[model samples]
Target: MEFTITNVILLFAVLLVIAVITTKFSSRLGLPSLVFFIAVGMALNHYIYFDNAYLAQLFGILALIVILFEGGLTTKWCHVRKVLLPSASLATIGVIATTLIIGFFATYILELEWLEGMMFGAIVGSTDAAAIFAVLGNKNIRTKLKATLEAESGSNDPMAIFLTVSFITLIQSHEMNFLSLVLSFFWEMGIGLVLGLLWGKVAVWMINKINLDSSGLYPVLSLALAVLTYSTVSFVHASGLLAVYVMAIFVGNSDLTYRTSIIRFNEGFGWMMHILMFILLGLLVFPNQLVSIAWQGMALALLLMFVARPIGVFLSMMFMKYSFQEKVFISWAGLRGAVPIVLATFPLIAGLEHSQMIFNVVFFVVFTSALFQGATISVLAQKLGFTGETKAPAPYSLELVSIGRTNSEIVEMTIEEGSAVVGKELRELELPEDTLITAIIRGNKIVTPRGTTSLQAGDILYVLVTKAQRETAKQIILEG
Candidate 1:
């Protein structure tokens, strides 16, 4: 069939529908929807010409900005704070370790140059944000572990990006010596950190104080802020990716009007970008070429999942209070997704030696990760006793809002099994003055709290609290 405008539109509509259905069945099948997305892209490759790595890189960069922004916007600062130091170590040191270990193996076994091997390692280094977010949403992992995994996945992209770009420069000119590389790392990360923190505050202030005339324009304004942060930071030779994540987190946690709407918008937008990005990358691959790299791909994937990742996790968390089982879970949770494939585009655009080989190997590793790790994560959690009864979705809707450092705020939370708030009477919980449990919904029943009312494991509490008591209320409920 010859291509036409109508046909293209219909094809896109079909793919969108398939994307939704793929997500609906993803958890049931123990497969991340990413597999289905990439499969679609591969299927379409025969019908279209999408072998342009340059174009793919541009689109990938934009999609990643959106993904990281949404990640920051949705993450709670309190949870991030708990895992901040350890997760930061993993994002920075863990990445370097993974890259060096994998790079050494690739250099020895594959007979590649040291720099080329490192490039391949750096390309596949990070745990993908899109994959982790999608898979974890369906699991019942504990709060701290989940937060650490999320924080690591969300923040580690910059390290991989730095390594990839640095190696590409070295492979091209061979002039970027060790001292220059170290200096570049500090220059990029230092600028990124400062700009991200500074702009995050500015973005939050703008969102809260701008008070757009139409509610619809608020999300648009937020989107603009994200793009502006990334582009402006990148132009100054800093890590724009890091800036987006930091800015999103700050704005997400701030007291802004219509915050929920902004979050909802970004979630939907991020999903669309994920779908499009994966499909496009898939379209760029030639399955026939993948056959030649099959054995090498499998070997590298196994070593990554079994050896290198565990080493990185154990070393990174050495001084932390994680148990053996928790370390094992984190090691197994290093599922690669689109990030590596997108990074592969860097080498391809750089026109370096072995670039195509690197791309093919990365595609295969991502496939294995999605098929193996993505499928087994939930089961592994259960095996290690890290999972509890999955929280059921809230049956009713609620929204909380306050303005300008006011003491009044609304909080909705599910009382997990074994949480401190569970099995305690409202009076015994000893909530702060002016803090009220407005209502408790258990299963399908709604109970107005009495002094003697006892909270259950599955109880969903609608709390109205003053700012002074917000942190205290959260500590009480989530302490379990």
Candidate 2:
């Protein structure tokens, strides 16, 4: 027992340290750090490495709860609200269409029974939030694009899980019944949504009701509640992942105390969970199986790239006003990660034929998706003009960050359409004695502001406040 505990501690230390060093090194090379994490897991898998997939899956469930909760907390509701209807529609209709399309194609192409092929399709249909969040979440993408992807990733899993499990039940009985399957899907999804919203509402109330001894402890307490809440919901046959994600979104966006600090803690914890999950997932992959799966997986990925995804997104965006470029980029960014592997388990546990085949195909799909889609989304974003403004690293919590501040500062000076600050000479309203208004950027033009220059309602001023009194001068300038 001592030896086993010691080994666990040692392995964990090694993995954690390696994860930190590797992710930083990989990020410098413009590669997603997740690839490195997976490689390390594959390296560990060499020569037995415990020889059990279930153990890693057990860890996956625990890790996923944390991941889901963190995801919920980090999501911005302001961004999602603008596109909720379209995003929700895409999440539901898109998953169903993608599954059906793939299922029918697989039926003919793989010569499998309709039910079996449908199961295969269902397992891979939903995008993995963990994977998507890890790679795409931090980009300075536009609000609409980011929210659409975020909502889709967060909400689509229940649909996929339902479809996967429903087919598993049918295959076990060697039959398909329309009404029963429909009812089951309806109950699971409805329950998952209702549970997530309710859990989020309760968790918000709890966070507000309790005043912890330390502000720092709030994040820990909230996270624990999130995990427990998730597990409890799932035990009652609800979707814990969905529940926690929704809960986090509410708590994250709400006017709770110490929210800024809590968000930072959750963000850091979320990254660690992502690193651990990818590594565990990678360890479960047998490199030999990947070699055999290479062609089929690559082919399926192409279908995703050229056929299924385009159809899915096209149908999804039917009434939505997304530009063609925006739609195209969305179609291209559907990377896969852990959820498919988890769903693949239904086949194995249900004693379905060729469970190993399902696992192998999923492993391959996730690999291709991460490698191909993950690497290319940025390039396409630029090409499609969806990257809006120039990109910068998202700043951390403690220190405020700004770009191009060497000689200039972008401070928010509120000129309420017709305020005195708006129609005043820079010399008269002139702000601080030292500060200079460099440029007033409105929409996209650089209006050079002089002593007589005035601000506009929708204008954003580029005031060059000195390094000293950058704060005090802005306050005085605005007060003037």
**What lDDT tens digits, residue by residue, belong to model 1 across residues 386-473?**
8888778857776645433453656777788878767778888767778888988888888988999988988888788765576687
For residues 72-119, could you state the per-residue lDDT of candidate 2 as single tens digits? Answer: 777889888899987888788888888888777766655678888888
lDDT per prediction?
0.86, 0.72
Clash counts for the predictions, in order: 2, 3
TM-score of each: 0.85, 0.79
Q: Which prediction has the highest lDDT against the true structure? A: 1
Candidate 1 clash pair list: 407-466, 407-467
